[model samples]
Target: MRRIAVLLPLLAIGVLAGCGGSSSSTAKPVVKVSGAFGQPPTIKIPAEKAGGSLTVKTLIHGTGPVLQRTDAFVGNYAIYIWSGTSHRLAQSSFTAHRPTLFAGQLLPGLETALIGQKMGSRVLAVIPPKDGFGTSGNPQAGVKPTDTLVFVVDMMKDFKANASATGTAESNGGKGLPTVTAVNGAAPTIKMPTSKPPATLVTRTLIKGSGPAVTKGQMVVAQYVGAIWSTGKVFDASWNRHQPFNFTIGATPTQVIAGWDKGLLGQTVGSRVMLVVPPADGYGKSGSPQAGIKGTDTLVFVVDVLGAFST
Candidate 1:
């Protein structure tokens, strides 16, 4: 969960956004499912069918805001491969996770299931092969391209965009860890450290925010640039991606390295902070070659805290 993750086909709608939703309307249901969201639902998989269109059925109605096509959404969802070994459960976000989903980031069939649905609503959707992974299946999740993907999505919250952090320029040399520099409101850059790595996590606030305080379990949205202390070369950066990434500070699953969980906790949103992580708090002795990191290497990061939300 540290780097950009490869989501299973059913959970891989992370690129952009799209539109569509399950409604109480003229569309007919081809598959029937029982039970509810929050608890595993009983699904009666439909007989194999040729390529077709998408369908939807609402098991629980909600009274929250109607999800719009352009809005960003976060929620818990479950996916089952239809017409396979007795409705195989493929993926789920119901356990210790909160995924950030937005328009254009969703598959066509999934877009339809999300729109028009209100927060707290649970939806059952049937996606034909054309609307799903198509002919080339997701081998990681065992979709064979011909597989039909079924989803039971739990609409959660629509996160409002957070204003980026703002502050005056300060001398970069006073910090005990790494020196940080920022352009005219651009992402901050880290000047690598020449000193031996700290034995524990080190946190220093370069800029402060007035927004809400970040708690331990709340999902944190931040833009960050990470580099190896030994070389001071960048390995990963959300700034380069032009988007912020988030993690549960100290949560069990999908939580980031220990340095982040400890460094950013209690910091207010819209703040800018730096983390100097020892090997123990970072990628550990094995290190991450993918990031050009070594076992004994330390890690440095300049993180811009953007937003925090609980899904």
Candidate 2:
């Protein structure tokens, strides 16, 4: 768990004055500004008064509105600190608790930017060190005395008003199995058993490497190939030509379908497993068109558990 300490002292205070208490008694501060990604610093300003362009270079697949605290939002995220050519710090989707930012639990800049964002909105906020960790920087963050941060946040869900229901789905019950039905070195076909205790048991110890076995709350990096079981139509695959998908097992909650969660449980690290995920555990009735999956689709996946990280 990466602890993002709240450093309010360094935050610039932008105050706004309004009319007398004849009608309204409170005075709200309003600040505004703008810029592009990777640009040099022109001046230091308070978060409430700060503003800028997102200038998205790559908008990964997402669904919904930009997340905002005012409107209520909750989800997992990945953060990375970047220096010229290297990443200073990085944290992937390792959240077990659906952090709630209702009032003031986040940085001023983040809170201001995230408020009003709709559900499923993925955003890339280019934050200067000033609006972020400030000059002294976050010692705990390993952020150097001088470093800018880039946060690639994926808003998986928003349950500002309703937390209990979403929270329950996020902490999936712990009991599932990895099923293998096909094999192809880098990408294999897999299936997740449906029976409440998973009646089917298929295992393949392909090219075993020494490491810890896959655990419940660990992060795993994997390459996979998925297709509809009935028609053998390819749906989604990371082995084609893209970065391997990374996820903290049981951390994403409903980010992945039930079938995927059940299929990946209890697999050893560095081993390839195939799974057959039924529609009930998959996308259900709302199949993804982009992936060519239908309501009654049965998914076949080949998962290569490249690595696992424990906290």
Among these predictions, the greatest TM-score belongs to: 1
Stretches of candidate 2 above 4 Å error? 1-210
**lDDT, candidate 1, 241-286, per-residue tens:** 5445666666766458878888888988877877888888888888
TM-scores for all candidates? 0.66, 0.41
Write model 2 residue lDDT over 1-311, tens digit each, in one string: 10112322212111111111111111222111223222211222233422222222223434576554433333444455555445432543333232222222454345444555555555454454555555666665566545544544444444322111100111111235434433234354444445443323333343343456777666556666776655656767765544355455665444466655666677666555556566667666887766778877766666666556563
Residue-pair clash count for candidate 2: 24
Alpha-carbon RMSD of each model: 5.7, 17.5
- Looking at model 2, residue 218 earns an lDDT score of 62
Minimum summed lDDT over a 10-residue window in model 1 is located at 16-25
Tell me how far the alpha carbon of residue 47 in candidate 2 is from the true structure, in angstroms, after superposition.
18
Q: After superposition, how far is residue 102 of candidate 1 from its true place, in Å?
A: 6.1
